[model samples]
Target: MVYQGNDPKSNDNYRAVFGASSAPFVTLLEELPDEKRNLRYSLFCDNLFTSFHLLAHFKQLGYEVTDTMRENRIPKNCPIAMKKKNRGSRIFIRP
Candidate 1:
């Protein structure tokens, strides 16, 4: 769908509808169905919209979201382990 910022009547400016100072996506989520308001739904979004704040918001709503984050965006405390040999190498990351 096209977001016609040129059309003032069109609520295409998310920042305007959601508010610039809002905790990011609060306004965006408000448009969701009332039944799904506080339920656990898996949200799959693009990397541009992924952030800890967004995830926390989803959690607050009892929902979950998934997206590929930049290396720097990942929590540094997560664990990672690796074992040798090209023939048999075991690399594991425990969340």
Candidate 2:
């Protein structure tokens, strides 16, 4: 997907490639604009894409990475580990 700016002079190119899995995502990234291509950006993906290589690439590009561990599926990697943590039914964190 691309977001077009209002003015031609202020226009920027943005692209998003959706895939069934991150394995393909990595492959797709190889085809995208690289840091040497003079582009600065970030990545927003699901937990299925939370891998060391992926993070490294985004970090190299000076891009902030955001990935949620829980989104109706099991997470492959979690920055915030859920292991040994208790899951209560009626507890919510929003204050």
- Which candidate number maximizes TM-score? 1
- Off by more than 4 A, model 1: 1-25, 75-95
Per-candidate TM-score against the hidden true structure: 0.49, 0.42
Clashing pairs in model 2, backbone N/Cα/C closer than 3 A: none
**Model 2 compared with the native: what TM-score?**
0.42
Q: Model 2: per-residue lDDT, tens digit, 1-95?
A: 33232333321222132223444554445556655444665667767656545565667756666665443454456444455567732222221
Cα lDDT of candidate 1 equals 0.51
Model 1 scores worst on lDDT over the 10 consecutive residues at 1-10
Model 2 ranges off by over 4 Å = 1-20, 33-37, 70-95
Give lDDT tens digits, candidate 1, residues 5-73.
343333445445423333245554666688766666776656565655555656667766665544454
